[model samples]
Target: MNLVSVQDLIEAGRQVSLTGSALAEQAKKGTPKQREYLYGLLVAGVEGLEGFRLFFRPFPRGSRA
Candidate 1:
């Protein structure tokens, strides 16, 4: 499997953080459509991070080779 670099993960985390912060600010005064957009970003960010986590985590010792 191809390994993801630490820098790449850091950049992804930064992007997600910025997007989440922006979403929070917009949510304070956003319209229904804007809220939906922000929600979508939030979900995408979360799922993306989870994917990265699973990708980087070491395999279990007892798992098949």
Candidate 2:
């Protein structure tokens, strides 16, 4: 998938819970390519956070959302 779609998927992941649960352990999520693509999504998310902080903006900032 492209970075844009990957970024969207990353954001969607934030809405779901997988911590401290059996599913979290059992879930074998993402393919090798997808896993690699996660780095880009992470970078995008960080950049979005930086933009929000620097501009003192609200959530879901910019074209990232």
The residue ranges of model 2 lying beyond 4 angstroms of the native Cα positions read: 1-28, 57-65
Compose the digit string of candidate 1's lDDT tens values, residues 1-65: 23433333334445667544544554656665655555556558978888999888988899965
On residues 1-65, what C-alpha lDDT tens digit does candidate 2 reach at each position? 44334444444445343233332232236554664565455566667777777887555646563
Worst 10 residues of 1 by lDDT: 1-10
Clashing pairs in 1: none
TM-score for all predictions?
A: 0.51, 0.39
Could you tell me the lDDT of residue 39 within candidate 2? Answer: 47
* Angstrom error at residue 6, model 1: 33
Candidate 1, residue 48: lDDT: 85
Error of 1 at 36 (Å): 0.2
CA-lDDT, candidates in order: 0.58, 0.50
